[model samples]
Target: MTKSISYRFALCICVLFSVANLSVADTLTVTWTGAIGELETTIMADTSADGTQAHAVYKLESNKTYLQRSTIVLESSCDIVGAAYGTGETPATIQPIPGDDGASQFAGWPAGNIKTYGEDQSYAFKNLLFNGVFADGSTTLFGVLATYGKGNTITVDHVTSVHNQVITYFCFGQEENWTLTNNTAVQYSCYPAGMYFGGFWWGGGGGWTGTVESLLIQNNTIEGAHGQAFVIYDNGLVNRTEGEVINVDHNTFVNIIDWPKFYRHGNNTRWTNNLFVNMAANGQTRNAANTNIALNNDHVGGHGKTATLYQGACTDSTLLADGNCWDRTNRNISYQNNAWMDTPELLDMFAMEPWCWDLPADSNGVVVTLCDTMIANQSKWAGDSTMSMFANGVYMSNNLHMSDRGWNLDPVYITAQTTRTRDWLDNGVHDTHTDHFWMHQADGDKITVEWPLPMDFSYLATSAAATHCTHGGPVGSTHHMDHPAGLTLNTNPDGIVASTFALKQNYPNPFNPSTEISFNLDEIADINLSIFNMLGQKVRTLTNGTKPAGVHTLEWDGRDEMGQRVSTGIYLYTLSNGSKTITKKMALMK
Candidate 1:
């Protein structure tokens, strides 16, 4: 009996020990130590109810690579000084003492921070940081400093960095599929950028000369170091030498005066739908073929009077080059009903990069300053090769400088917020970014030419209708051009695109009592207009048939096919041809 009791007690002790160990293993903390290390974590997809990836583990070591196909979380304290724990270097670089700087207790300090390896491995990062390489007097930090041949993918979210020399890039160098969203980057250097902003430290080894190809810079807010401006450069060295595509959309460039310098947005890069205020493109003239529309960017207006607002000079005109084939390119480009505001007092709009589509102009001789500019050109086949200034210039009523803008000619009146101003350049006062401009018609009325109603299409044609004899320029400073002769751009809002199909917002969105929706078909086509609820349930069908395209309006009574009223908090309306479908959201009020 005594022997049996002893055995039972021993077994009980083992069971308790196992449970204790499991509990402790459930939670793990990462910190700096003498040795470089990696914390290998397992990732199981479909563990969550939705069958999407539910959980993952990350392991990385100080000064040692975590290898590829791995993810690790590098965290720093909210304190400015605590940022020191983020980088692989010893915290002594920023905080020589435990609390000397804003460094926090990571259970392991600077020595414990980890680094990653990307080449010949699959690696990714989610919610990571590389922080604190600065003097106690200042914080210098970097986030992720990537250097390697392109391998795997990386993703970072909510990555924050202090504007310090040492702890700079929250996520620095990158290659391949990088999706960085909602990140806050603050840099403070004498020159401001310190080491964090650019991956310059990555050196020249791994094709490090140029910007990463196929990178998406989306939804990020970057604040340049004080006194130091930001410029997005095209690194000549990249994995794919030809046809690289980088998309810089939905991102905010704040306090960054000079725009990215390279004329090519990485071979076939896209710069669209971004907001640029209080900054300038800094003389960066992008080519239409190489760089997509420099579209829908707003000038903050506050910088209008300062030299900071002037974006360098147009040193490159890739858009005008022969490879662009200009109109012959048959390239697909579009605008999303974007808005720009310029006051009535600023002139010299020609200095800005040319917008691919037509811009606003003033009727009634109401001169307006340009918020943006573009020079349309004829197709390469036309052999003229000059930018057609898509507006008519009346030198005291001489249409000699007139170029056609193809949009619906209509009588519309919407007063500009900024009153007309004189242009100092032409011995005429200029307008700000917001003053109203006109296109074909004066006094808000479309020019009637005894032609078809939609003949005033946004696409300018010199009678062939197959070609767009472009809107030329105050061009390369020399202002040399070859087009339909004497065309010049005025501050007009009737630039071709919007006038084609004015897709107005639905009334009483989330609505009832019948809301009116309208559209303009450039030509006849089979079309279907539909309304759907948030759940993707079909709520209403407005129009479905073959119709001549000009301008047409339809009404939705917030009712289903049977004309029965439906409840709604939010609904989506979709328009479709046989092949292309576009859906936009609308709300119903009652």
Candidate 2:
């Protein structure tokens, strides 16, 4: 409890309160004496230009550091928290100010250390410690920028960022909710020289389209070099507006350099129960120019070698007739129960050889026939199977590929070596190819986890391979590491209750005008709930009645049963109570 006794207990509660009868949700602690701009002059003197005193709550004082010479322009609805000086003190940092180079002191293109502005605001950055470097260190492009707004509600809970090229950007909103929970991002610098690092960079780019009604990247932990641990850009003319969601759940992601890049377009994307480790670890130097390439080169291991857990793309055929493309027959993307591992030294550095390219000898040594016809048209366009892109209305279940070096990480033979497939793992009506378990066919042992990762990046809860890869029971990222313990210092993290009889999965799931479907009952049940489509029929019927005994939420507005609206793709809801039934799937992207 240092920092001069937490700044003399926040100056003894501001000399026993009475700063003109504090209100607007009180709290204004700000005690960083070594100030430069003094936290934007105490948040512009508790902002209130018409945001009705902007619900102030600056706080920050724990192990003090705040300097920040420029950006901090939040303009309204506030709550910056971070004062609890107890369990291991620290946290209260906010860097930049010594030779400040916050991305060249902002002139354009993402430059923030806290930048939000107007519109429907709500911002909150709890237990702060964003040290994106500066104060004589370097890097720092953004830590909380909230790219212009429209219904904002941002919330970077338990914040921690380190190098930060982008740790929380949020963009072009229309409904916006973005909540990066239990945050920790540690992006190893590659800075603004050629962008891309992100540990939470949301959608809608330049031309700024809209819609983002919710993007909760849960239980965050993201680590190293991260060329993507949730970039999800959009703006090909934006789609999914009926409830729009992008929930990358239960995150943990370690040596990241891939997986979660989903640029160009998206819709109801849900990569659930996440915990990928060493994914593409700088796949041959991320923005590659052959930085010593050779991890068994064939461009180092099969299928897009690392960045494909649905890295959506679209080369504008007028934005694919405006459905804005990521079109898994209209993006209802879902990769469930995720838990990948990798590190048989990164799966033998992505093993899969054969295709030794050295080509270039033209001075009569005879190799260059235009470099062997551009290497056989790039290996026949990388082993084309009709240049694949299979997986429609995508959904893969019980995911759990592993390899703490026990081999076999086979994402369906690495997505059949290219273009994209999970063709429902060979279509026997969805998941088959032995329904996901690879680490040499499971059965136990090898699941150790501990290489610069354990400050709650947990995995060894008596691992029988993490209890045979459970999801819904334990999967990955169960949060807690940066300032955990009852989250004091203006407490925040809590809400998550619901034990037993579940049924979730349906919040903006490719939705377009409405969607919400929670469940959980463990008691007074008589439920039915309905919805069906994809030929199983039953178009709508939301709830046949009697529910009680706990959590229930229900919404669906993309109507039917006479209310109209229904067309799009994949549906199926079904909850039931007659001896318990459950069904799931959703997607309605109009």
Candidate 3:
């Protein structure tokens, strides 16, 4: 049936509504009549003094590309095929203010700018950017910003901080629930980050209580930053927080002179599955040794491919390096398929610098290091409850490449976890994907994870070697369809298409009860998914990984940060790979 003009226009409007009000979908048009500032402010106004909000909306004509500067700044999830920048003053550098109160302005700054907020407010944006542009106003405007608080949910999504400098976008808070996935950060720097988290006033010592638990950063492409890519624990912020499960997976890093600085005393935070290509891609003409890749600058991955973390230390922490594909995975692991859950391969034992001392520098010749000390053993350290792979300090397991090296972040400290493992094959004749099933209890107590073995993904790395993958093809080829002989879009070219992303809607949305939200991947890349209330506050994160694509899910019962079921209302589910995006709406019927 031929559609009428009004009906056609309504369909067009619906296509325009990404995450926000769907009603506007039928009336909006993508025209530039020089109206940018007010629209951008509308998005900014969504923020709160309490710091408990985050949002992303990929509103675009499915056929059209390119995002406007105003839309990029105002909207959370968008694809700008062209150039985009934000209005506002370029942020001046902000040093650790000695006496900034959590509720008031940043130390020594004017009023109205809340220096400290809750973790619940910082909803990490996970969006994809393809052939696009981004502009952040000053280091303070926020590409990523986290504020840990009594609120329990850290949100990080596929958001690329690019081509703008002022205030950084990432921050941290008291209770950590950080998840940064598949976002690209390029040619942007100032303040403390091209990509960063300015939270917890962590320069002096680890402050606050409770482990910054369940945080993951994966599958991101970052380049060119003025300050450190990561910053943790101020000198005064240190407070013994243990069992923090931090994961860095399947991401690529380049042109970042200064990497993340660490407190070195905390038992939380894990780094793995990420590869740094040009460790010295920024500045290394006279400083060759400095050019090498070093987590704390103790060693280098070198030009071709070799990187080191933890200043060449071999101690048992929560870190396992597998995403690098080669650098960190070179360590010895004895267990089979234990690819990414192993310790790092340090460069030189004696030459290893202490972690705090070997930080990277910004474009300006500034040496940055984290200094808060005098932490009490009980600070932030939880006695129990950590949902991670290596739940303990360090252990060894047989692996695909080498013998295992580090301890597992076990959710429970018992001898073993009630776990399940499944294998997917690419056989053109008899490939099995959904058939492999096991017993599941539906109880949310145990951590459930699904992975693709090295042999499973070998097709991408070894198509010529028939013995590698069951139904294999060359790298970047379509060899992963259900039938090995069939060629399909394994993942989209932009990485944002529905085919490229394994997205799922929040289950039991608008329910007085809860439901399960799930997704499946076809390959290994960083992933991020979040649940947001209609007002744009991030409520929870389901999963983030640099894991091989298969299937995955997380349960979000109808509840708020306080563990109370929220009022009956509308909500949205967002997923991204920093290149593509998909969103679904669910309801919570009180």
Candidate 4:
């Protein structure tokens, strides 16, 4: 069951999964008992025949720690979910077995902790803790390695990783939908290898192909990462069809040594309502000369670029037939309503550079500025007038940056602050809270009230700025601010227990087709479960009757009483027991 797969073999696997004739779909559940090789053995034995049609759910024992000694190749779609006894109970944990050379079997590509290769499949990992700390500081382990798939839906939700090199890495081909939400990564110090989250070139010359239908990275808390946060790259071959998107929203990134790097995606890419703090820490000099001029503050604090968007070389003329090349204009990328706290003066928020050949050329083949091209193509390039094209095609607005100006009123400090602020303003970045004091916040400058742990970025409630900040709520990630509870397993438990009435968050918040909604009832009571639109109109009543006490779960297939599919938007779900009522929100993203 232990094997290494090459790129060619990986591609073949994807093709095989796509063309294979699957049988009647069935759900298979397996329980683990902390034994070595048993989990993988059970999975392979049960699904050895016609795996594509089987929906396997591998349930790990509650709060137990399991050692993954080798890569587990998933031949089929499945859900690996950990069990918990009750509220505040710890979930099962999976960590790499300690090795002599600090290298575990979960190294990558050829091997990894968990590997899945297929097309048009659904894979979910949830309610589990992954500890990737190694002895010799090896940075090769990938919690989940997925490769070469199209129209695949992958979800990594409610998972926690500690000191992991890469929590998840998707390589080669395109995915219909990929979501990384409600996850927590603590001390993710990976360097000289990979990113904490994203895909990379895996032994290919031209690089990954196809267009991602949708990518959602939301509600995650990344506390400390040494190298990069997200590094998604797409070869400039295919353009996403209209309405496709890559959304990185409502996440908190702090103590990041480097920034997110994205390339050659011409879709509606958005970075919205995110909170960043203490970025570019200790400079971006990773065992090399500090060549970055922006971060040259005697190697103290704030001395690097925040992000870079590159238009990869789209030199293939054959792709031009369908207009499947990198879009140099980058009109669909946007950064809005984001907030940065304790940012240094010189860090450029974003930098966009066209491919070497993508620079505009005149009829005589002479290089010209983007402004020159805009003048020639007036109808095509008409939008923001203030931008000087320094960061072309990027629309930035309503972004807030607050830095502490300490007692040192040096001319260099003042000049750097004003210069960056003016540059942003001139480039069509409209900050609604802009004022004279923004550049000289001597009295107002302060650090987060909850420093280091549970870093709270909420402004004072009395301040008028609080109302304008972050769309009626706080600006940062609201979940898992404090580190997740450590894994503590009770080897012997009486039985399944329920202590309170609770309605848990939906499995996949922005879901397509269907999603699960679960709740706990301490005692038998008459309960009513219904879904309502934003306008307070009830769309469907899932259940309305007396139910016994225990954990109750149901699935909403994104439909109404008339059996017609609902439009994409936020929908409210209410759970009422005649006395106590609990309401929550879920999104149906078609």
Candidate 5:
């Protein structure tokens, strides 16, 4: 829809409803209109004194991309506690203030000039689809002037943009007086359109005092940078700047040609769980490596066809390279504690192959062998959970029941499977999908699947309860099962339902900060409740103890093992008794 029509419709309805008397609620919506074009934003916010609550919506003309010299400040008199900013599709959730005192203001300055509110006072932006036209590097997409104070919190989690010629996502100035945690740039890749620099850049200097200590860079996926993915420069912010901890973890960078430079200032940094591919001419570079630690990272396609690993002026006991893997060889391409040298003359151990810096034996990395030609072909039919290939045909699996489709099939009971490939066929021939017979017991205890290793395509298949089932396919031609019959409920002649356990849906489905999870027990049983991220990594363990024969509730404060608040994302929580295990998915908004 066009912005003018959408804006007119919203304004007309808002004005129409203004006459009706309504009870006061905790939420308020404030709108801002730009002078030129149809540029407007409406934000709904929570009115608690210190509670973090804000959501914004933007409407712009069809051709118009950005607004100039305009700012939208929310209508709230209460002091700013915490704030978050992102797109409407992906709301940037506010992380908890670890030591908030309810009266503390998070923004650096008091509310004043409207233009500087986003940086000076606390504010957020959403639904901004701007195509930046920046030639010189002087302009910043959003600049936050650093002012000294405590209890400051800012997050820019979900932003989508292009034409980042000189566009910086966030620019912070001098004086460090806040803790930035639980920030993310996930799922979407920040592609470099024009002249490229860092996708997310920080630094115009920081405070000398020890207010800000740590920077957590996690879960970002970026593509093709001309400069560095992250750039941190020094302007004398702190004396021993290298002593401050910087964690760069769980990010994927594709085709960063020139730089992923962690130069002089970012000495005290740990690069972990990162995947680097196509670091073209300037393969990964590290300077002032006295305090840098790189571990457990996977890298492929360096400066040239020969995968390159570069180090500058790093001496013994200075650079710690361990448990890192690379696509360097035909097989077993993994290493641990890879010894590196300063120059080719120092290659006395491996004389013929002087570039062999990593120790030959006792390597700590795992390598898998695959030809360059086979990598693309084999990747198509590999790693998917639902589609498996045998010597004869391809096997498939799905949750939807399709037994009535004139094919011999069995029911599949597994609910948490994501690898089921739909409509997969091998060599345009026979295929079997989800033919495992699942038998549900009287109690909600154990459900098992019984299937033979190899099936005779010529014979008739049998069904449960002694119901004779015949194979149906192209007559006289060999074929496998076509579709899956989902879970089948087992009942006795009396028609009484039986269940030993039940897990209820979490209250307040999309929640902020905290939520309650409840479950029921038919009899006394030991239980284990845990939370896992989409990547299957356990975020937190809620409980590991015994429960009685009743309903029990547990509250999660959206924290991990170290009591740090987690980012906004989809999480899975599982309730596992000894006999049966059930899992459900939930969303953490902030």
Candidate 6:
């Protein structure tokens, strides 16, 4: 009996030790450290029915890519909350710190703060790069919250999400409805909107009437988004009991189609200190109660100043747009203390006065160089590879080489050294890296066209003797061409390949009898080059067969499919392979 009791006591001690070890093991930790790409993490509650804590950390080295198609997903029914950590506001100020590239730089949410509230969480991402995304692609790359509980807080700060074509970074309200006042989104990169607040249309759900309160969006740089920076709409549903109090401030937006627009919203929607450049259309359209729009500044780039303010039909009288710096007029809305400082063309286009008829008139507003306001720092003027700086001039370098120090239309290549330039003596040949030429629209037209230089003639041919000349055939030859690798025919002994596919503007555009339509193919493919009249009727078929890729030219004799010359008018020439198609317009002066 004594021996048996001793054995039982020993077994009890072993059981207790195992239980203690299991308790400590319940704490979960997930970590990912590597180059930029897709990442995922899943955490579940301990099986003991006791709420255990789980922690996750992600670290990236550096990335210069965009539209990465990377994803960080966190799916759980347990408690999940997170805070972004790092500082990456100015690239020059920060010396590209090792181990952290993207997580810390943005325009929104306070820098370093951690507050947790949320039940059954999804993902939190930081320090990443993306190339581009599409609408039909995996829309949810980050997180999809399936359940909602009270006092649940989700925080996303100090994260840079850039160059997504259409997919939103984060999505809420899919399976069950939940109210969240502790959720925060800030400091993102280029997304359709920094954040989208609505129900998933394809998820077979009705509208989301969940309350999202005290959400803060600030201090992020966004550009190249095709839709509004932020949108909260439920199929235009009226009074369905969804509440939201959003604060959008201190963000930089460029090349945006629309600003933050709210069709169905709650109270206390405020937008301030947000800088918008190269806006394609309207700024803000908030038709909500207690809506305060103030101190928002904007500039329309080369695209026309069609930005509008259409609050004229708001039923809520509390909607006030005051102390903003946009094109404000009484044409469609009631506004005050707003200012307008557009170009003479914009001034004539709008035909509205500078000052709005509201209290605290906009006396401090004035027009300045649009580029100056964009760079934020004058020292970062030319060398900054991140943002494009627009200019209009031609200057000579220290070597007496003429250079076009003006806008390079391609935003992807912004560094001063990489920008395209034309030397005065090059006969029309441009540098290898340059994509556009700074030229007057016409012989006397002062406005520069930044016309895309011909790919075949654009690059400089450098021989071993350091002699530089145009790469293509004799300067005036129409077939000066380079074939993309697979597009070249086996007959060419030199085995040269084309690097890019392009359709050049037809030369001698107003030719009476015939004109040359030129294009370069990068790869061999079945092609269909056809001409269509302004009325969308196929007037002539240029080529509809397999063609070896190189720079090829076809003579359109200004004739129709019936082999008869058509009347003088405008026509569109379309170039289509099996996968891609492009169109260009031309005029025939018969």
Best by lDDT: 2
After superposing candidate 2 on the true structure, give the runs of residues whose Cα lies further than 4 Å from its correct spot. Answer: 1-39, 44-68, 71-112, 115-140, 145-165, 169-196, 199-215, 218-226, 231-258, 261-301, 305-590
Index of the highest-TM-score prediction: 4
Checking candidate 2 for backbone clashes, the offending pairs are 242-512, 242-513, 343-346, 344-405
| Candidate 4 residue-wise lDDT, 1-590, digit = tens | 10111211121221332222223233344565676556666665665455542344667776566666676676556678787556555567665664555545555453456666665556778887766544233333544455555555567777776545443445454534556777776544343322223221121113433344445576677755544566544322134544334556667776554454332243355676676664543232111212222222222222233343345456767555646555555645666776665333323322212112134476999873321011111111112221422265667677665433221113332233334333333332324433212222223322101112223333443323232223444444545222122211110021122335656556554455788886667778899889988677899999999877655778999999999999767677888887767776655644
Measured with C-alpha atoms, the lDDT of residue 568 in candidate 6 is 62
Query: Candidate 5 residues 35-149, lDDT tens each?
Result: 3211222222332233222321122222222233223244321121112333332221111111123221223232111211121122223322333222122222222112333
Per-model TM-score on C-alpha atoms: 0.32, 0.28, 0.38, 0.57, 0.32, 0.32
1 against 6, candidate with superior TM-score: 1
Residue-pair clashes, model 6: 29
Whole-model alpha-carbon lDDT for candidate 4: 0.49
Between candidates 2 and 4, name the one with more favorable lDDT.
2
Number of clashing pairs per prediction, in order? 106, 4, 108, 1, 11, 29
What local lDDT score does residue 247 receive in model 3, on the 0 to 100 scale? Answer: 37
lDDT of 3 by residue, 372-454 (tens): 11112111111111111122332222212212222221212111101110011111111232221211212421111111101
What are the runs in model 6 whose C-alpha is more than 4 Å off? Answer: 1-38, 41-53, 56-73, 76-151, 174-210, 234-245, 263-267, 282-590
Write the number of the candidate with greater TM-score, choosing between 4 and 6: 4
- How do all the candidates rank in terms of TM-score, highest first? 4, 3, 1, 5, 6, 2
- Give the Å error, residue 370, model 5: 40
Off by over 4 Å in 4: 1-29, 53-55, 85-88, 98-103, 107-111, 134-140, 191-211, 234-239, 263-267, 282-306, 309-313, 317-322, 343-391, 403-470, 480-590
Q: Give the TM-score of candidate 2.
A: 0.28
Candidate 6 per-residue lDDT over residues 127-187, each given as its tens digit: 3322222212222122122223332224343333322223233223332222121122211
